[model samples]
Target: MQILPELGAAVASRRKHLGLKQGEVAAMSGVSQEVLSRFERGKVAEFGSRKLLAILGVLGMEIQFVPFIPAGSLDDLRLERGGGS
Candidate 1:
């Protein structure tokens, strides 16, 4: 959920970095320009994961998930639950 904005920002940044317009991305990825605009605005719920992945592939980006552990007390609890010794 929180990653949506990050993903949008990454897409926007990458597009800009590559000097590509939204139309170019839309054509390359075979997604509608309207959808690409929505994606850039972080309205990711409207698009399917496969379409998003295709668009990202054109941008030379891939999604990666890294497990996140909260700091302080939460981290301790996670470690304990995982049998850390």
Candidate 2:
């Protein structure tokens, strides 16, 4: 999975592991439940990055820009990860 969906899954997993419902997280994060649900499902194609960061903050997470890797390197990593088609 790409980073966004993977991040979403991680957030969902963490929320579930903490015994927090989507509505509770949304309320605590000042986001709508629908938005939170969509985000958790990785359907946030139109969601803003600011809101994403806000949710991450509420989840005790943060986003960071790490060093870049070339597309070829990513492909090689994917293949090594057994994600190749």
Candidate 3:
């Protein structure tokens, strides 16, 4: 739920691809076993970004952002002030 399922899947997939165990990943990432278990089960929202980053780092992953649209498009929009023109 809440976009966590994809994250969990990614973590799980990456972990398996790296041939790492849950406990091993937890130890390497400095996250708790319970938290890692939950995350692999698609409960990533329960964990914070810091913890997620730690886990992802151990999995050889890092967070990155990509813009979906041009920045100027947002600034061109105007909000209605009231009934007045």
As for candidate 1, its clashing pairs are none
User: Which of the two candidates, 1 or 2, achieves a greater lDDT against the reference?
Assistant: 1
- TM-score of each predicted structure versus truth: 0.74, 0.73, 0.72
Worst 10 residues of 3 by lDDT: 76-85
Q: Give the per-residue lDDT of model 1 (tens digit) for 1-85.
A: 4767778788999999999999999999999998888888887665678888999999999888799865657668779799665
Candidate 2 wrongly placed segments (more than 4 Å): 73-85
Q: Whose lDDT is greatest here?
A: 1
Off by over 4 Å in 1: 70-85
lDDT of 2 by residue, 1-85 (tens): 3776787898899889888999988998889999888887988766678877888888888877788766667778889899996
Q: What's the number of clashes in each of the models?
A: 0, 0, 0
Cα miss at 60, model 2 (Å)?
A: 0.7
Q: What overall lDDT, based on C-alpha atoms, would model 2 receive against the true structure?
A: 0.83
Q: How far off is residue 59 in model 3, in Å?
A: 0.9
Q: What does the lDDT read for residue 73 in candidate 1?
A: 76
